[model samples]
Structures are given as structure tokens and as C-alpha cells.
Target: MTQPDLSVLDDHFSAMTWGWVGDRGTWTTDAARASLDALEQLGCSWIVLAYATLQATPQSTRIDYAAAPTLTDDEVRWGIRESRRRGWKICLKPVVNVANGTWRGFIGFFDQDVPGEPTWAEWFASYTDYIVHHARIAEEEGVELFVIGCEMVMTDGREAEWRALIERVREVYSGLVTYNCDKYQEDRLTWWDAVDVISASGYYPTGEWPRQLDRIEPVVRRHGKPFLFIEAGCPSRDTSPQRPNDWTLEGAPSGQAQADYLDEMFTACAARDWVGGFALWDWPAALYNPADAAANTDYCMYAKPGEAIVRDYYASRRSG
Candidate 1:
């Protein structure tokens, strides 16, 4: 396959913003359509479609290799069509471990008979097939990008295998490729050779966020490559602490507090040379209503202050 240069950030690079798709879980075609409508209205150029469920069964893992998920294909296709219709880009990112740790089998990894947890190789071999299967579809469907993995902290060290998998994927698809990593593991990852961009799920506090990155500049300079903050999240509406000294905003009670923090981060990133782009951790307001919403706190970007932050940032980049 001819490898085309896919560097989205360059001197002529324009600013682009994307949000995490709302966590509506599984839905019928109608619900999915409604969700797409809502996201398009928000001016999202790219969307991360999630298909993993809280209780995915073993049978679910046997998704047809040739096509996207059948149940929500309409929703998936609607997202693709509408995004293309509006000149937007869509990337399919099916997250595993949504059930905390239970549904791993459904997404293909360890069998129920296995005792403790399955080995990383066991998971990667199976999961990468699923990812590549869908990725090939994204390629045919003309989607903008495709994610191979997300937040699988347990399997981060299998570098050689990951590189091989990405190289194989490159043969079938000619679009951007990346694996989303937890922020702390940014430097630990070694599979960059086969990937187009280095991405991480990172979130920072409200003040001088990029300043925290000064410590990593020497390491990054050594890599001689630009990085994307592919996933960074802050609580859009919460004033209380979720994690100790967590990056959540302080003093600002309204949703706007969250937006302000994200705005600061985007400004800091876009004005720099090393930072390519930032994908806000999530949008569509799921933080507040995660499954078992009453028991869990919310972290999504719906009507919250962070929503405006995204809108304004994109506007600034577009106009700049």
C-alpha cells in the first residue's frame, strides 16, 4: 500500500477540534440518529464511536468481520454519512473494559474457563483482529481515522507485537492510526514507529496546564516527533474532588469552570510547536449519567462549561 503523509499539523495546519461521543451505550437506529444530530449541531468535526457495552456477551464478540456492527449499523452509518455530508470526520473507537472488568470476554480476550486474567498476547491477538476488521470498513467507508486500542493499561508493554499489528493494518488501510494511552504511560510506549501520531488520555488541572509538560520536553525532543493530546478530560460540572488533587477546576462552580480549564489547555497547546492537537476527553454529557448514573458522578461535555470551551477553541483556530 502506498503510505501517504498524514501529518494533520503543519505550518499550513489549521485548527480542528473533536469531542468524545456521548455514552448512550447501545441504541437502536433512531436513538443513534438522534445522538448524531445532537453532535453535529455542536459543530464536532470528528467523533469517536464506542460500541462496547456494560454487559456484552460472548456472542457479541463474534461480530461479522466484513461489516460494522449490525444492530447499530444505521447509527454508525448515519454518523459516517452525516459527518461526510457536513465535511466532518469520524473515527470509530470501540472501548473495552466498560464493564469495569467483566465484559472482556464479549470483546474477545480471556475465556470464562480461564482462572485469573488472560495474558496480553491473548488479548491483543484477538482484539486487534476486531479492530482491524472494523478499521478496514472505516477505510472503505471513507472515515477520517481509526483507533487500534484505548486505555488497555495492562497490555502496554507488548511493544513488538503492537508494531507488527500496526504495520499489518497499514497494508489494508491508508488513513491515520493511533493507540490511545493513559497519560502517565506516554513515555513508556515504544510502538510509535508504526503509528502516524502519538496519542494519550491526559487531563490536567486548571492552572498552567502545559507548564506541567516542560519536564517532558527533553524526552520529546529526543523523539523528534510532534504529539497529540488525543484524550484529556476534566469534570465539566463538578466542584468537588473525584480523585485527590484531581485536575478538576476549583472556585468555578458552573459548567463554565470546566470549559475555562479546557480553554486554557487548548490555547497552551495550539500556540506551541510540539503539540499538534488536543481531543477533549469526552463530550455529549455522560460524566453525570454513567450507567448507574445515580451512584456515579458525571464527566461528559454536554451543556457544561467545557462545551463552550471546545466551541470557542475551534472557532479561534478556524479564524486564526
Candidate 2:
């Protein structure tokens, strides 16, 4: 794939990064607000707020999306308004398969279509309606970007349906629309043309840093459009591995190693004339953030020593 010229997103990438706030739809209003403030201090220029889930629980399923407290239009509006007030962009991403970890927390869908399960059509229909509602909320809140789904690998074969759903989203969301695919699901890249930008979650292992982007850059450039790292995170100081996939926050090197890896990746991306902006997977450590609270020392660096390196690197960028 040829690399798309991304000079367009240069300003956005100057000091930009992807901020992970965990499932906001699962948090209290006060918590979400506080988290946003903390993220701002960490230099988060954009946020991908998760809004849905996989299980049929009261917390994840919203009967009246407009009024649902955790993710109602009011809450979304609050986030966007605050972001704009602080000069930031909000990318509202309502996902599925959150609780049951379906498709690695991308398309939070249950096996709702099989026997003794909710039908896929029923779940998809509801999710589509939910996405429409989110679009309306984005309009009201001035949210610039909205993501329909993230990481639905098993169900990617249903490309036709996904395309139609994106078209419908276009009818409501005047701003950019995109979906979040996992690292390897390049097959579905073409289906995202309806979106203003093509996006992927780049959580390839820490060791895969610069090389990870190198591998993806060629393909992304071929798409000839702006790209976004919809999701990303680095490990903390003391996290162990549960299992090793392509990427993980567990049992990696030290915070310095993580920082060096990110610096190399960001520098490489910045040097690229074709690549657009990139959002780091997360924010610097803070007291209240889940990664800080649970002490999951692997991925998701909130207040690790690696932060000093990141802060200094950007500071240098600002100086030069």
C-alpha cells in the first residue's frame, strides 16, 4: 500500500496523543469530569471515550440513550464542552463486547445471534440506533469525531452491513465518522471510506514500537487519508503478563524502555511527511485513574517515570 501524505494532520500531531479513560459509561459523572481534567494536564489533545458494552447489564445497556446518566447526551455534551473550553477535540467511541471481552474489547458484541443468545441482527440494530443517538449528541456537543465500533474481528465478514450502517451514520453526524479496527484487520480498511479518517488501535508490543508503525505506515499511506490511533497504552512500573499476544503491558522492560520506545515511534511518525497525527495510547499517571488505582503496573502509563521522558521530549519539540 502506498503511504498517504499526512502533512494535513501535522498541527494535530505536534503534541497530540490518544488518552484512554477506561469505560466512562461505567463511571460516575464526577469521575469522568475529574478524569478529563487530569488528562488535560498530561497533554491529551484528544480522547476516545468508550460508551457501550457487551453484556445485557443495566450499566452497559441504555434503554433511553438521551437520558442515560452515564452516557446521556447531557454527559457527552459536558465532555465536549469542557474539551472545547480547554481547546481539545473529543472522539466519542461507543463500543461493544466490553464486559465479556469480545473481539479483544473492540466490537463489544455478545453471541446474541446463536441459540439461547440475542440475535446479531437485534444487537446490531440496537447498536446502530445507539450510534445514531451518539451522532445526534455529537452534533449537539460539537464533537468533531465519532467512532461506530472497535475491534469486531470475528464479525468483519459482514462488510456490506457495516458499510450501510456507516452511510446511515453520515446522515446524522456532520462531523467525521470512523470505526476502530484492531491492529491486523486491514481487510476491512476499504469498508471505512464512508469515514472522514481511517483509524486503528496500535497496541503492538512495546518492543514492536517503531517497527510496528513502519509496518502499518506503508498500508496506511496507501489509503491516502488521515489516520488516527484510536486506542493505545503503555505498561506501568510493576505489571506481569497474563498472556503474550502481539502486544501487552505485562512483563515488559522498565519505564525508561517504554518511554524510549514511544519516543522512537513518535519521532519516526513525525519525520514521516505522509503520515497524519497520532495519539499516544494513554495519559501520564494520576492518583484517581484506574491504572493508578488498581496498580496494574503493565500497560497504561499514567504517572510512571516514563512520563518524565515523554514530557521532556515534547518540551523539546516545543522549543525546536
Which candidate wins on lDDT?
2
Report the lDDT tens digits of candidate 2 across residue range 67-113: 43335555556656766777766677766544443333343336434
Clashes of each: 7, 26
Superposition TM-score, candidate 2 onto the true structure: 0.74
Worst 10 residues of 1 by lDDT: 11-20
lDDT of each: 0.56, 0.56
Question: Once superposed on the true structure, which residue ranges of model 1 sit more than 4 Å away at CA?
Answer: 7-28, 53-75, 98-117, 240-253, 285-297
* lDDT for residue 28 in candidate 1, whole number 0-100: 34
